[model samples]
Target chain A: MADIRSKIADIYSLEQLSLKKSWVHDRHPLVKLASTFLFIILVVSFDRYELARLAPFIFYPVILMALSETPWPIVLKRFALTLPFCLFAGISNVIFERKTAFILMGLNISVGVVSLFSIVFRAFLCVTAVLLLIAVTPMSRITAQLRRLHLPDIFVTLFEMLYRYIAVLLGEASTMYTAYMLRSTEFKGLQMRHMGSFAGQLLIRSYDRAERVYNAMKCRGYDSFAARGKKKRLSAADYLYLAATCLPLIALRIIDVRAAYSIVF
Target chain B: MIEIKNISVTYPDGTSAISDISLAIGDGESAALIGANGAGKTTLLLSIVGVLPAERGLISVDGIELGKKSLSEVRRRVGMVFQDPDDQLFMPLIYDDVAFGPRNLGLSEEAVEKRVDAALSSLGIAHLRDRSSLRLSGGEKRIAAIATVLAMEPTMMIFDEPTAFLDPKARRNLINLLRRLPHGKLIATHDLSFAEEVCPRAILLKNGRIFADGRTGELIRDDRLMDECGVEALR
Candidate 1:
């Protein structure tokens, strides 16, 4: 239960970082959102064997971390959470393909080894781009941008509600789990036999909570089409930031700095 | 003024919560709706906002009937503070929650900012404007919930179990705050002492009917009526 509580606290640490009044955080959310999307697309478009070319993309995360003043440990901790699936896929490639690609440390390295490294690198780049975006842009701002994009209200509202209540629901579930653990002395966790009632109770509680929330919303004159907070237009600096981010990403994808450097050296 | 005429509400499952209840609250008046658990206090309060459809009756606020067309306008005029502050304060930050109602009402940015600031400062929670709702203490959450509704500038206010989980100091503070508000207030509570302290008029509901209605002091002092209503005498 304490672990659940701490995890809930950790979920908001990035959001806390987003609140800081820095240049990156102060830029328009739509610009940040579009630039991040472009960066991820560019990073993922690399060829499977383009590990050397993908190396320069590390500058994006490094520069973003320095500019935003977000701690490296926090970003890396979250980045670690995305590694398992990439590791599994990479390991499979290493097992299936063994054709030699290069020699290093007096030993031949297989094409599979290179591809595995490429996959892991690509995953890291893509995850870092997204993490930096969210680390600097608040969720409300993101939703506001979604509204500006003419997305359907149901989708936007559902996203907002899910983000807001997920922690509360998780807290309720953890408290119930603690009570259950205290009751049965012999069991380590909730047993399969009691799963029916355990899950049913949570469902009923959530349903009742949803109804009460709807009533509260209705009492506040929230018709389905009620006006939301209008977002301000992007300033000249915001456009400059967007161009600075997107143009470099596009250039990096088209002309690999690694290829250019190797020929010059 | 608020008026309910023979309004009865029945759940879809055929359980009748309120049966032919008639009541009226004059302008600038405060009333306590006293009832035991499952005695329809919440249903009655919800009905006032047109949230729960009444099976048969008419509810009017200052001669404007509550129907499909007037519900939006009526809701704007009547603010409700729900039993659980968690349910009412859904926005990520306290400022947004306080601004939610006014924003929905299509207020301009300057006006919304003014109302939110005034509401928070009035509740003495101006310091919590940027804090998330999940991080607030129970008392702070309750105060923030009230500020959310107050920002809408409602003429009347309704509270459902406002002091359900407050500590003694917090309860006293809330009661004091309630005393200073000038709007017509209808507080549905099981707290007998609370009713006597804040309300001059009281209506007792039993089994979906009004069992008693009179001055709060006289009604709560009557041991026989208090016993019959299943509420404890003043403590």
Candidate 2:
């Protein structure tokens, strides 16, 4: 239960980081959002064997992290959480595709190996781009930008609520787990037989809590329309930030920096 | 003034939560709704703001009867601070949560900002304007929850277990703050000592019915009534 509580705290620490003052943190949310979206698309559009093309994309996360004063360890820790799934999706390539793509150090390098590295590299860039976006921009600002973009109210509201209530749901689960552990003599965690009832109880508790939360929201005049504050117009700096980050990504996607380097050298 | 006359509320499953409960709280009056667990304190509060519909009878806030049509107006007039601050402070930032009601009231952003500032400053939490409610201390969260309602500029305030998770100092701070506020208040709490300190009048509920209603001093002294209602008298 304590572990769960700490994890919940850790989740909010990212939002805390977003509150810090820095150049990247101060960028308009729409510009930051657009740049991140463009970065992801460019990174993901690369061919499986073009790992070198993705190398320059590292500059995005590195530069943004430095500018925003976001700590690398926290971002890396969250990135690690997504590593396993990326590996799982790409692992099969090593076994199935064994064709030699090149020779390095008198040894054959398989296309499969290159592709797997490319997949992982792409995943890193995309994930880090997203993490950087969120680390610099508060969730409220992001959701507000989404609303400004004319996204469906239900979808945007769900997105915002889901992010906020995840902590609430985990807190509920932690409390119930603590109560369960207190009652049972054995300390090997919950038994399989009790798992069903435990989950059902958690669901019921969550439902009750959700209903109360909704009532509270309604009392405060929370209609489906989210209350947005004054809309901020994009400044020249915002456009500069967007152009500086995104134009290079687009140029890189079209120019093939690695091929150009080989020819020039 | 807030008034409830013969109002009875039941769950959708047909279980009676509160029945034939009638009470009136006048302008600038601070009253404590004292009751045991499941004594319908929460249900009655919900019905007052029309969050929970009454099966029968009438509830009015300042001569405006509560119904589907008057709900928004009633809610605007009566600011309800929920028992759990987490439930009340749902926005990402305290400023946004505080601004929520005013924005819904169709106030200009400038007006909303003023209301938020005024509310936060009134609670002495102006520094927490940009802070996330999730990261606030228990006491701070409670105060922030109150600010969310205060920004609405309501005529009356309702608190459900305002001191449930507070330390002694925080509880004392809350009591002082409540006493200083000029709005009419209906506080549902089990803290008899707290009730005695902040409220001049007390209404006791048992089995969803009005057990007693009188001055706080007389009711807290009635050991018989206190015991019957499953609430301990202040030692």
Candidate 3:
């Protein structure tokens, strides 16, 4: 129950931060969205052995965080939630491919070790770029941008409703869990026998709630077609931000900065 | 004006929620639909806006019958407030929720903004325009929900259990707010005091039928009808 409450708090905290007014936050959502998408693609395009190349990508999130005035701890907390899968994949690479790639001082650096580091670094940069986009851009703006891009109205509305209702579903589940726990004694978790019924009940409740929500939307003149607010045009500063973000990432993808640094050494 | 003729709504399992009910509310008239749980207050309220499909009846708003072609137009003129504010408020922010109806109506951005502002200020919640809907207290959510409907500039407003889960102060404030609004209202509430204060007419429902319909003053004093509808008998 406490965990779910904190989860809700975490989501709201990010939402609160996105509401702050800053140069980065003020950039047109479409521009920020495109830049972040390009950033992820560039980060993941690197060769598996290019660990040093990904290090410079850290500057993107760092600069954006500094400009947006969003603290590091909040972004890192969300990043930590995504770390386990990357860690598992990287560890597998370390275990399988152990051929030595280089010799430094008295040590041999294996191919697997280099790839592992590169994988972890790529994960860090990619996740950070996505998080930075959300941390700076309000979700409503992003969905509006999606609609402007001619995405299917049904898909966009689904995306919006899913994001909006997640907190409500969590709250409902938490209340049900609390009620069940109160009726039981010394139970560390829900009994396996009760899991089926408990989950089924939650599903039924969610379905009923969705019906009511749809009716509410229908009552407000919402037809099956989606309607978005007026589009916000990109200002001169937004274009500058876009150029600053995309140009260097594309340049790094074309030229291996890591190999260049190694040659200098 | 709103009119219902011989309407009956049945569930898929063959249980009738609204059974052969007919009523009407003329221009600028307020009416209270009072009933106990399962007496079909919500079912009937939903039917007014063409949300619920009536198996055997016709509902017309301003002489436009409720059907596929007229549903959207009817919805634009008849705004409904659901029982749960969370359900009604699906947007991330209050401003968006309030602007939703007007935007759907194809209003210009400037007009939508103006209407949203007017609605929020009328509800005394202009300061909460940017606040997230999920974080609002119960009363604030209720007020925000009303604002969302009011922004549509509907000719008539329908609320299902408007005072559910409200504190005394919030309830009083809501009743006062409803009294001041110019649009006609058909409110379904168990709060007889709220009905007395805002609505001049009252309709009592029992077993999916209208048990009694009369002036609010005359109806509340009818001990037999009050008892039949499962509401408290006036002292």
- Each model's Cα RMSD: 2.6, 3.0, 2.7
Full ranking by lDDT: 2, 3, 1
Task: Name the regions of candidate 2 deviating beyond 4 angstroms.
Answer: A228-231, A263-265, B20-22, B55-73, B90-121, B125-140, B223-235
Ranking by TM-score: 1, 3, 2
lDDT of 2 at A134: 85
Q: Each model's TM-score, in the order given?
A: 0.91, 0.88, 0.91
Interface RMSD (Å) of candidate 3: 2.5
Alpha-carbon DockQ of candidate 3: 0.59
Residues A7-113, model 2: lDDT tens digits: 88788778778878898888889899899989988888888999877788899899898888899999999999999998888889988999999999999989988
- DockQ, each predicted model: 0.61, 0.55, 0.59
Winner by lDDT between candidate 3 and candidate 2: 2
lDDT (tens digit, per residue) of candidate 1 on A1-265: 7698678767767776786778899898889989888888888888888888888888888888888998988888888998998888899778888998889998999989999999988998888888888789877668767777788988988887777667667777898899999999998989999999988998788777877887898888776455445668889999998888888778888886886888888
Clashing pairs in 1: none
Model 1 residue B159 CA deviation (Å) reads: 0.8
**lDDT on C-alpha atoms for all candidate structures:** 0.86, 0.88, 0.86
Positional deviation of residue B21's Cα in model 1 after best superposition, in angstroms: 2.4
For model 3, what TM-score does chain A reach? 0.91
How far out, in Å, is residue B86 in model 1? 1.8
